[model samples]
Target: MANQSKIKVCVAGATGWAGSELAKAIAVSGELELVAAISRQHAGKSLNEVLDIAGTKIPVFATIEEALTVPCDVLVEYTKPGVAKHHILTAIAKGVNVVVGTSGLSDEDYEEIGIKAAAHQQSVLAVGNFAISVVLLNKFAEMAARYMSNWEIIDYASAGKIDAPSGSARELAYRLSQVKKQELQVSMEHTQGVKETRGADINGTRVHSLRLPGFVISLEAIFGMPDEKLTLKHEAGNSSKPYVTGAFLAIKKVGSFTGLKRGLDSVID
Candidate 1:
C-alpha cells in the first residue's frame, strides 16, 4: 500500500445513515479506495448488496477486528459513543489512523485517545459534527470568546438522542475555552432560583442541553458584552448531506498529523 495514489479506508458504520452516504462517496472517489466495511447487521454481505453501489463488492465485517485484517491507511468511525472509543483505540493500536464522526465522547475520552495515538505515532481526528456550518459556528464562537468573556452554550438535539450537549456544542465549548476563560458575573451557586437551570460548567463555560422533538442538531453560543450581545449558531436538517464534505475533508487530512486532534478547524488551519 506504500506509495499508493489512493488512500485505503475502512468504514465502521457502513450501513448507517451518514456512514452509508460516505461509503457511497468512497465507492466512486478516485482518491480513496474502500477496502473493507463494518456493519454488524450487514456482515457476510457485500457492500453492493447493502449500499446498492455498483462495482463495489467489498466484504462487510461485523467488527473492526475483522475489518482491519485487510490492511488500510485510515478507519472512519461513525458509530455510537459506547463502542466508538474502543474502535478508535483498537484502530490506533493496530497502526491505523482514524477519523471520528461519532459524538458523546467526553474530554477524558479524548485525553486517553491522545496519549495512545501519540505513543503509537498514529493520527486520530475527532470531529463532533462535520457540517461546514458547524465548523464556521465554532470558529465564530472562538473569535467571540477572545474578547467577550460572558458567553454560554445551548445544545439542542433530537428527543431520542441519548447524549446531552451534542458534539457540536461540546466542541464549541472546548474551542471557546481555548481562547479565554468565560467570565461569570453571577456564579451558579448564588443563583436565586434552581441552580440546575444555569447549565453545566464545561471548561469554564456554562452549557445548557435541550433534548426535544423536531431538532436534528443545533448549537448556539450567546456572548454578551456590557452594551451588546452576539449570538453565533448552527443548525442541521434531517438530511445528513451537510456532513459529507467536511468528513471527506477530514479523511483526506487525518493522516497528515500523528496524534489525536479535536474539531475540523484544527486541521483546517
Candidate 2:
C-alpha cells in the first residue's frame, strides 16, 4: 500500500493550457509529488524543461498508459472534454483517486462515473469550473433563484470553445433546479420574424451561449420581476491559474470521498 502521508500524482494532458498550469502547481505543492506527466507531443521531456522548474526531471510520457507504468496515488486530469471521461475512468479502474477540472461532461456521464466509483469503492471529484469566482457566482445565482423567478442565463466563451452554453451554465442550471422551480413565460407577441435568439433550454432555464474571439468565460443570470430586475454575473480571463488552489484542494479531499462528487462547493466548507 502506498503511504498516505505523501501522495504521488500523475498529470494527464500535461503540455496543454490548464495541464501545464496544474503541473506547475503540483510541482510546488510540496504535499504531492509529481511522479509522472503525460503529453503525447512532448514525451520523454523533463518536467524542468516542460514547465521550467529547477532541478526536476520528472519524465513526460506520450500517454496516460505509459505514465501509469509508474505508481501514483492520484490522477489529475486537465485534458479536453472529449478525452476527460476515458482518462478518469482509467484512473479509477486502476485504483487511483481523481481530481478533474475538465469541462463538458453531462450529468448522465457523471452519474455513470459515480456508479463505477461506487462499485470500486473509489473516489472521483469533478469540477465544471474551478475558479473561486465562478463558485461564488453559482452560490449567488442559486440564492437568487430562491427569491427570484423568470430568470435566464447567458453564457459566453471564446469561439474555439467546443461546448455551447458551457459546463458552468449547466452546473448553474443544476443548482438552480435544486433551489426552486423557475417558471419561464415566453412572450407570444412576436415582432417581425426574430425567433432564433431565444437560446437553449436547460432543465427549465434559458441559456444563451456567446462565443467570440476575445471572450474568456463569462455568465450572467438575469432575473426580472414586476418592477425590478437583478443581474448576477462572473467573468474569467486568460489565465486559468485561479483554479489551481481549488484543484489542489480537491486533490487533497477526493481521497476521503467514496464515489463521484460534483462541484467544488460539495467538498468545500
C-alpha lDDT values of all predictions: 0.89, 0.83
Model 1 residue pairs with clashes? none
What is the per-residue lDDT of model 2 for residues 1-269, given as tens digits with 9 covering 90 to 100? 33356788898887788878888878877687888988878888887797897655788987777788889988998777788888888888888888887778888888889999998999998877888888898888877777777788999999999888688898888778888887646552452476557776687777889999999889898988889999988998889788788878888889887998888888986
lDDT of 1 by residue, 219-269 (tens): 888999889999888888888878889988999999998898999988998
How accurate locally is residue 123 in candidate 1, as Cα lDDT from 0 to 100?
Answer: 99
Best by TM-score: 1
Query: Please, what is the TM-score per model?
Result: 0.96, 0.91
> Model 2 off-target regions past 4 Å?
1-4, 187-195
Model 1 TM-score relative to the real fold: 0.96
Show how many residue pairs clash in every candidate, following the order shown.
0, 0
Per-residue lDDT of 255 in model 2: 89
How close to the true structure is residue 146 of candidate 2, measured as C-alpha lDDT? 76
Q: Cα deviation of 124 in candidate 1 (Å)?
A: 0.5
